[model samples]
Target: MEWLVSGLIFLHVTSGAVALVTFWLPLLLPKGKQAHRVTGRVFAISMIVCGVIAMVLASFHLTSPQWVEGAADTRLQLGWMMLYLGLLATVLVLFGLKTVRNKGRHHLYKTTWILFLHGALALLAAWVFWLGWSQRELLLIGVAFIAFLMVPGNLRFILRKPVAAPGKLRREWLYQHFTSMIGAGIAGYSAFLSFGAAMYMPTHAFNPYLWTIPTILGVSFMMWLSKRQPRYD
Candidate 1:
């Protein structure tokens, strides 16, 4: 079991590194170009791989003897956090991809599975918030709020119909795609930075200010990008 966990960690880290690098390429390259498409696909796949591995690792953590013994430790906290983040990343990336694929047909994107995913994440966010408050762990509290921030906008996008105006639907889908992808990037950066700090700078691992850096930078960039009308071709 230990060996299996170690192997999963290796794959998770490897795929996460690939995701981190490829995430920038699509944004930097000319949009709708073959290079951008290929790199974007790579980024999406890598993120999915990382997220799935994270959930599996979280399961291992949660089911460990310490947890079963009702021990409250960092490991247990991380298990919940990992589960939340993994699902969050997966949903954001898939949402972005689906928005692009179903552009101008918003109704088609509201499949049962997609709706279920959103609902599950929303419930998890609440549970995480409760856990954070009870444990007094600011990191988990903040992460829960981040998930909360996504829920309303996502629900709105999934349920609401686009206005009957020329180019409005296109713009809506375009913005949704960009927003979701950038949000996924934020999740990737947060996990990477947090893991790095925990491994190399343990003292700063739980620093409240350190955790906010990714959100701050990512949101600033996201806002800047939102102002521009990106070309699909």
Candidate 2:
């Protein structure tokens, strides 16, 4: 069982690293280029593999507490963290893919489904925060807040109106594509910073500054890059 967990960890880390690297290639390359498409495919596949393996490994931790060598409380905390991170990363990437494909007007059914998921997640996060406050679990409270923030964007999709064609008036699909991909990139970076390279960081590395770095950088870069996109004229 130990060996199996170790193998899953190795697979998860390796795929995540691949995703982290390949995700940048498409951002640098011109849109609609073959290289961009190929690299984007690689990045998407790697992210899916990484997310799936991460959840599987987290399940192992949750089911077999004896297999974990850390303090019992710490192990349990880590298990829940893994599950949350895995779900977040996987769902975010999947939604990013969906956004790119949704070039037409938003469908009520699709938006409603997504809205339901985000609403449920937001409620869950609120419950977690309340529970954490009662239990004095600072980590849980912090994570729950982050989860709450993630839901707001999904909420927007439900309220958004139909958009014009590409470059006509509001290039909604293009904007969504840009935002979703950059959001995925932020998630990839955060995972790497929190887990892959965590050994090099200080013990008190879970602060807001550390967690928000990827998001801040990614959004700034996206704004600049989107400006460079060719106009319809």
Quote the lDDT for 128 in model 2.
52
Task: Report the number of the highest-lDDT candidate.
Answer: 1
Clashes of each: 0, 0
> For each candidate, C-alpha RMSD in Å?
2.7, 3.7
Worst 10 residues of 2 by lDDT: 197-206
lDDT of each: 0.81, 0.67
For model 1, residues 1-233, the per-residue Cα lDDT tens digits are 66787789999999999998999999889988999889999999999999999888888778875333233586677778888888888998998899879887867977998899989999998998898899887878877777787767878888987665555334677777877787787778877776677668866665667658878877787778877765232
Model 2 Cα lDDT, one tens digit per residue, 26-86: 8888887999889988888888788778778777677887776555655555566566666
Best by TM-score: 1
Scored by lDDT, model 2 comes in at 0.67
List TM-scores for all candidates, in order. Answer: 0.91, 0.78
Output the TM-score of candidate 1: 0.91
